[model samples]
Target: MDLLKSLLVSASGLKAQNGRMRIIAENVANANSTGRTPQDDPYRRKIATFRSHFDKELGAEKVELGKVARDESDFDTRYEPGHPAADANGYVKLPNVNTLIETVDMREAQRSYEANLNVIESTRTMLQRTIDILKS
Candidate 1:
């Protein structure tokens, strides 16, 4: 039962990390996306939050993906008078998405996912070993 619960917890973490990875990917994809028109806003970076809930059936605390919120931080302004999205003041609003930040987030999420996978794999191996010992 404990092993099962452990596996469930790890699975939840994997799911959460996967969600985070997806958000990071989206940010990276829209890093260069600027507003088409002067009146339109540029792409905003998306952030993922995780929630922990107790699963009665699994008897463990499982992680769940929380609301995907947008970063409300100020958009970067670039002086591009020739750009279509440039305002009358010759300032263009660039996307809030930072490629370096997104890249770092992606790497962190990947590591977390890999860690959760390792936990699941280890749990399975331990369970197998226990069964083998019982048989012997």
Candidate 2:
């Protein structure tokens, strides 16, 4: 029963991490996206959030992907007078997404996903061994 609960918990974590990675990928994909016009805003970075709650049936705390929030940080600016999205001052607004930070976040999410998978695998192995012993 405890093993089953562990599996459920780990599965929840895996799902959460997967969602986080997807959000990170989206941010990376739009890292260089710019506004079509000077008055428009560029792509905004999105942040993934997680929520944890106790599962009554599983008798364990499980994590889940929560609402994606937009980053409120200021956008970067570049001097590009000829650009279509350039402002009157010859400065173009850049997306808030930072590839370096996104890369780091992706790595962390991947590691977390792997860890949850490992826990699930380990639990399955232990359950299999238990069944084998019982059969013997």
Candidate 3:
């Protein structure tokens, strides 16, 4: 019974982590994206937040995505006089996204997702063993 509940909890974790990975991937995809106008801002990196809630049905504290918050850090500027988004001073505002950071976040999300998958797999194995024992 508790194992079934654990499966539910792990499923929630997998969902949350999958969402987090999606956000991270978006950030990475927009790393080189810039605005078309000089006065416009470039793409901003988004971070995924998680919160835990007690699920009455599963009787466990499950995690869920809270918000996709924007990164407030300053955008990196590059000297690109020919670029359309270049300012009067020939400086272009690049997206406030770092590939290294996104890569790290993606790896973390992948690990968390894998961990949840392992939990689900183990629980299913236990359930199958129980059924076999009963049949024997």
Query: Quick one: best lDDT, which candidate?
Result: 2
TM-score of 1: 0.95
Candidate 1 lDDT over residue span 18-57, tens digit each? 9999889989888889999899899999999999998888
Task: Provide the lowest-lDDT 10-residue window in model 3.
Answer: 53-62
Residues 1-136, candidate 3: write the lDDT tens digits.
5898989999999999999999998999999999999999999999899999998877789999997898999999999999999999999999999999999989989999999999999999999999999999
Candidate 2 regions exceeding 4 Å error are: none
How do the residues 1-136 of candidate 2 rate in per-residue lDDT, one tens digit apiece?
Answer: 6899989999999999999999999999998899999998999999999999988877889999999999999999999999999999999999999899999999999999999999999999999999999999
Model 1: CA > 4 A from native: none
> What's the best-to-worst order under TM-score?
3, 2, 1
Q: Which pairs clash (backbone N, Cα, C closer than 3 Å) in model 3?
A: none
Instruction: Report how far off residue 127 is in candidate 3 (Å).
Output: 0.5
Instruction: Arrange candidates, best lDDT first.
Output: 2, 3, 1
The 0-to-1 C-alpha lDDT of every candidate, in the order given, reads: 0.92, 0.96, 0.94
Better of 1 and 3 by TM-score: 3
lDDT (0-100) at residue 9 of candidate 1? 92
Q: After superposition on all CA atoms, how large is the RMSD of candidate 1?
A: 1.1
Q: Model 1: which ten-residue window has the lowest total lDDT? A: 55-64
Q: What is the clash count for each candidate, in the order shown?
A: 0, 0, 0
